[model samples]
Target: MKYDTIIIGAGMSGLAAGVRLAYYEKKVCILERHTTIGGLNSFYRLRDRNYDVGLHAVTNYAAPGTRTGPMAKLLKQLRLRWDDFDLSPQVCSSVVFPGHKIEFANNHGEFIEAVCAEFPQQADGFRKLVKHIEEFDELDLSQEAVSGRKVLGEFLSDRLLIDMLFCPLMFYGSAIPNDMDFSQFVIMYKSIFVQGFARPFAGVRQILRTLTRHYKQLGGELKLRQGVQEILTKNGKAVGVRLDDGTEIEADNVLSSAGIVETHRLCGTSLPTPEPAYGELSFNEVIFVLDRQPQDIGHNETIVFYNNTEDFIYAPPEAPIDTRSGIICSPNNFKYVDSQQLEEGFIRITALANPQYWMSIPDEEYYPAKQHWCDQMAAAAVEHIPDFRPHIVDTDIFTPRTIKKYTGHLNGAVYGAPHKILDGTTGVENLFICGTDQGFLGIVGSMLSGITIANNHLLR
Candidate 1:
């Protein structure tokens, strides 16, 4: 097969790339090893129930009539209407510590009010922080690097509040937990805080469907279950790709969303340089299918970012996750359905997990270890989430191994490689990188990365 561009992986980035190239009337082909789409942001069904995997909510929602943020531009470029996405704004989310709790409303003013209420002394500093973020441009790499801790320290003297502010941002966005770069911290803060979050009425599946339908309508070719074995290159430039079954498909250029390290491995020849550290962070996630509504069990919040410790450490613990620092998301709350109106509720809890630790466990001890952690996480969750123990009708657990198997990430690293910024260039001419590796954090960011590369690098 021959095409103008061949994109590997049918994730959001790959799909978005295909859509843009195809919209310009170019021949684009998207190949996926898995039968479904969305990569990490995909869904599955078990016993006639749908379970969403990759989203707590689509962060950084761009409301209708305002083509402002990244999400807005993406929809406008794709010719998709805002009505296509059924979105519900979150009621509120809280960051809780030992003696203090800060709840944030969807409105920016309300959120700022809540923050200022806790630390009135830093109120002026908080306004300055916003002004700085608004004026700062993360795309400008000429500026010196700044750490998130340093930025927070400049504004607030209270150490606990700094940790509290970063707890959710680190979990939701940061790959470098100990100290996330200030640029990344700024970008995440803009996306999550400035733009705010909203749940799609139909969940992630609807977003995938919209992208796939648009791509197909624009004459893009989508090949599922077709794995690319090698990226064919000659004279240090990408030419095409070879499928797992040895079928070679030629393209003018190749775009890979399989991640930087993973894509490098697909090159048959040994590059004359050392590869950067690939897999950095991974997560241990649990999905709980409750028998009753979330509000019925007294867990009324849509999402809560809670921690047991006064100081937050983003990395995985040496032992089990007993610290009780994690995100609790109630998917049902997105629709604003009351306890009496809702049927069942879905809650997903995520924790930073050591991929190496899980990989070293012997085959005989794997399931036992998983059971122990599951029990511990559930027990710890009850302290924050009401009726967590008794209301669990069913449960599903996914380890780093499972993530590796599905996503082809070396360590099941949630965010591909550390310090992977935009430009999508991977030192190999004509082969560009996108998705998490391109430095955009959430779902909207990934799609924007795809569009950025397609227009800036490819179409240019």
Candidate 2:
């Protein structure tokens, strides 16, 4: 069947694009391989308990009634309301290194003050860096690839501070090892430190359901269990897609959230030179379901980014899980309205993992390995936060293999490719890429990625 656009994958980028396109009365269909939507940020139930797959914190949080920022603009573009996301701002979060700790909330000024208070010698440089960041146009699609670390070095003299700053940004968004694309760095910095983190009281389902319902009301077609096998092309132009069942659907244009290298390979072609490297940055998400809130144990921070060693290492670890550095998120700590609270407490820890080991692990050994690492990772995490093992009633863990199974990313790279196609262009005339490899980051950025690509390329 011929149509206007067939968007592959039902993740944030794909769904948001579907909603935007459908809102304009374009014939649009979203094909999701998974039975449900949300992609990496999906939700599931096990033993009668709900769990979020990829959500740690929804960064770039803007309070309700706010007229600007990514959050507000996302709502505006999709024709959604401010309360649709039900975002509760983070109470506070911290970055803990060897001898220094910097705490920040939604206030950019407070974060700046904390940084200056901790690093008295580098205060001038830090302020200058902030000023430069404010002046820099990180949204320019034509901006050349520059090193975030090198740029930080130009302003800040301390390597430790640089690494600390890179820790949270890299863990949450960086695709490249130990460094980030400068634009990406700015985008993430602004989203996290500037705008800060927040979450829906109902978890990822809140945002996913809102997007899904909105898209359907706009007459968007959502087809689940329809896995795309290939992109049907003619004379180097993408016409549509072939489903796994060999059902071919035609469209005037094709948009993909399948990642850069993976998307090109589906076309039976290679990306023209400077061949994009497959991302190796994947992590093991170990979630502990506790009997009580983390605050009961005196661990009240919204999130903690900790590094045991002097220098922060952001690369794929040689070990099964790198507990030396990781992210600890207590979903129970957000400042929800009406004193809303989750039924159960959750301590979700994400640590860099060796993709090769996890992806190649024997099916028989998977659960055992997960259990062993879960125990070990929690041990490392207790050093920076209150020990919650006594309170954990149940535990769940997923690795890079799970990421690949769910998202189809090579090496289960959470952020897709090391290189980004900022403009979403491909060699094929009507084929484009969005989501992770397109370079906008986090939930807010990812949703905006879909809207930007659709507005720029498809809906014209």
- Each model's backbone clash number: 0, 0
lDDT tens per residue, model 2, 185-231: 99999999999999999999999999999999999999999999899
Model 1 C-alpha lDDT per residue in residues 394-451, reported as the tens digit of each score:
9888888778878787888888787674678887778888888877767887888888
Task: For candidate 2, give the lDDT of residue 124.
Answer: 99
lDDT per model, in order? 0.80, 0.91
lDDT of 1 at 206: 80
Query: What is the model-wide C-alpha lDDT for candidate 1?
Result: 0.80
Q: Which candidate is the best by lDDT?
A: 2
- Model 2 misplaced stretches (Cα beyond 4 Å): 270-275
| Candidate 1 accuracy as TM-score | 0.95
How high is each candidate's TM-score? 0.95, 0.98
The candidate that wins on TM-score is: 2
